[model samples]
Target: MSADHAHALPAGVRPPTYHHFEDLAQQEESEKLGMWAFLITEVMFFGALFTAYTVYRNLYPEAFMDASSKLNWKLGAVNTLVLIVSSLTMALAIRAAQTGKYSQVIWQTVATMIFGATFLVVKYFEYMHKYHDGLMPGPTLFFTDVFGEHTPQARIFFSIYFAMTGLHAFHMVVGLGILTWVLIKARKRYFTPDRYLALENVGLYWHFVDLVWIFLFPMLYLLGAHYGLGH
Candidate 1:
């Protein structure tokens, strides 16, 4: 339904219902439920990738380890830390929205976006380094000596790496876009304590994105380190 507000609302009360929703409470419930449902689907999608990664890792343990080591764990670790802090800020922004503190929401959202941007920037540099090293998997890949007899399997590992991390980064970029919308609404004082479900939904998305990274950091960067298997 179009977001056109009901004909009547008390002064300063944001319109809380669309035509299909019985009241503000119903609207809030529906929106929150919708976000949860969407998140469940995302969980299943990533689960498939995790399953594939695990199967392949078992099949070619050494090649996976070797390919993983070519990655800069230090940079991955920093991005992980950055995203953790961004999750904190996202939570703070949601809290601020709940408390009707528009100023806090604005600043907190800005902090979240800054941290997210920092992550993408770090990732950009990492991608560039790979490009220069020819570690990126494709027709032009040149890391044969590094993996010795396991070059082809190592290539497969990098394919999974790029698919997983690249997808994760793409989600972060989308989250940033959502944050931008939330920031704009915040500046307009569009959300009040009673009508901030949009902000809450955005928080859900931001947290989910961060959670994916938390898993990814270990899966991609910590695998080789755990067994003392790679340089």
Candidate 2:
């Protein structure tokens, strides 16, 4: 390669060079490996929570089933669909970034954020319903009134419910922030066919968040659903 070509930024990539890597390919690989490592840690964190949930659930089977029945499955199902759609849009955004379709990248990223926000809004209503019904994690008269003798055991289920879903929601919020940043950079045309690591990395994170919710929905909302649980 010529001296000028070696020093010059790749076509469509803006200033602030990736200092640690010799070229775009190395940088991209490093970024991907870092993201995968972070995601693996996240998986372990969620796995521990799931293990605890399973243990408690098995120990208090009837109470857990009864508690699960109280959740609105319809809303959970709807949010699940919304998140899945967001993951699709995130993937599309990455594709657009790779193809240098800046306009499509912006639109797809915006769509993904909208879907993510929709999920949060639905989650808000769900939490509000639990609050009004006194189904929150702590002590409440509603549990006693509704579950009667099983109130203590029911609280344990709700505790795990809040911990898992609340953590997932927090990740969604973080993902939204990441997407917003990507949208801003994208508007500046800071990405190109050869250099769009930010978009790709954020896409992976968004998909990971969506995958967590996919598991959460089934575990928290659909367990023992055949036992006459209402939506």
**TM-scores for every predicted model:** 0.90, 0.89
Candidate 2 residue lDDT tens string, 43-69: 999999999998998898888878888
User: How many angstroms is residue 103 displaced in model 1 relative to the true structure, after the best TM-score fit?
Assistant: 0.8
TM-score of 2: 0.89
lDDT of each: 0.85, 0.85
Pairs that collide, model 1: none
Worst 10 residues of 2 by lDDT: 1-10
